[model samples]
Target: MSTQDPQPESTGSIRRVESSTAASGSSVEETPPSTETTESSSRQSLFAEEELSVLRLRWDEVQSGFVDDPRECVQKADGLVSDVVDRLTTGFSEARSRLEEQWARGEEGSTEDLRLALKRYREFFQRLLAL
Candidate 1:
């Protein structure tokens, strides 16, 4: 006969694997996010930034023509600026959604940065359009 002390049962020693019927009859397993998803998101954000920068540069180029003109020229430039602002606003909205979603996945550094940059650029462009 072995000499051993009898141990009392405790919650820590319990192993209860409940049936799925207790919940939804199914267990969900989380999968890591795909690289393709991340890369595609990154590419879209980069494209938005590049597009805005190019548009801004073109606006500056065009504004040169109005530098020495009358009020009519200023009004025309104002209209053009408004159109560009609308386009940039749309792009900024889309990028903000994507960047926010990506950021929710715990990748905050670059994604947060891009979101802020896009937002700032949007505001800056709108200010210019107002002028």
Candidate 2:
């Protein structure tokens, strides 16, 4: 019924879902990683193990409920996905903030740039007035 081979988890941080579980959308709980993942290279940036487990349980409930109310199940899945996205983006947002701070040292100094530009403009104006 399927042609896809079971693939290993690319990042140590994210748990790999079984081929069956992924396809059927049942038992979406992530299995323990076969090998330890590096923290810096973790696929999931923000969610801790406990939080991921909770999300898996909640997702299982959402999938199981499809038999009763498909519409509600879809809505719940949407919410869960949205929550994960928010968590992921929060990591990026924080990293960007830190980078901005680091760049303030000289990499991206708008203050100095503005000062230089203003001085150049004054010199250009004075030269034009002389002409």
Candidate 3:
């Protein structure tokens, strides 16, 4: 007697899928991982660094002018303002240093140093704008 079993035909209407219960559990339908987003973010950081450097240079120039003529009348008003500016500048510089140190330590992501750095940067910009 013949003992061959009949094979099932593939139906075009319903496709066969790998069941999750199968060997590898489930087939991962992978979309392409993105590097473009990371590249753009890096570019943005570089741009911000460049722009901040320019602003720092400009601040230095403005500060130098304020000290060029140290007359009694001008000194009276300028001295207090200069002191405030100096404090802000120093704070900003300290924040930048801490941020750089943290980044060097590979703590760039979700760090307090980054937050402090951004905050100080804003303060520096505001001070510059006030001038």
The C-alpha lDDT values of all candidates are 0.43, 0.45, 0.38
Off by over 4 Å in 1: 1-83, 111-126
lDDT of 2 at 73: 95
Clashes of 3: 0
Task: List, residue by residue over 15-125, the lDDT tens digit for candidate 2.
Answer: 321122222332322443232322212322233465555666777889889999999999998887676656544543554565577687767645433343333333333
Backbone clashes in model 2, listed as residue pairs = none
- Displacement of the residue 46 alpha carbon in candidate 1, Å: 14
Candidate 1: residue 32 Cα off by (Å): 41
4-94: candidate 1 lDDT, tens digit per residue? 1111111112111122232232333234325553333322322234444554555565566675775756676676556554554565565
Clashing pairs in 3: none
Per-candidate TM-scores read 0.28, 0.46, 0.35
Off by over 4 Å in 3: 1-71, 109-116, 123-131
- Model 2 scores a TM of 0.46
- Give the candidates in order of lDDT, highest first: 2, 1, 3
Of 1 and 2, which scores higher on TM-score? 2
Which candidate's lDDT is highest?
Answer: 2
**In candidate 2, which residue ranges exceed 4 Å CA deviation?**
1-46, 105-131
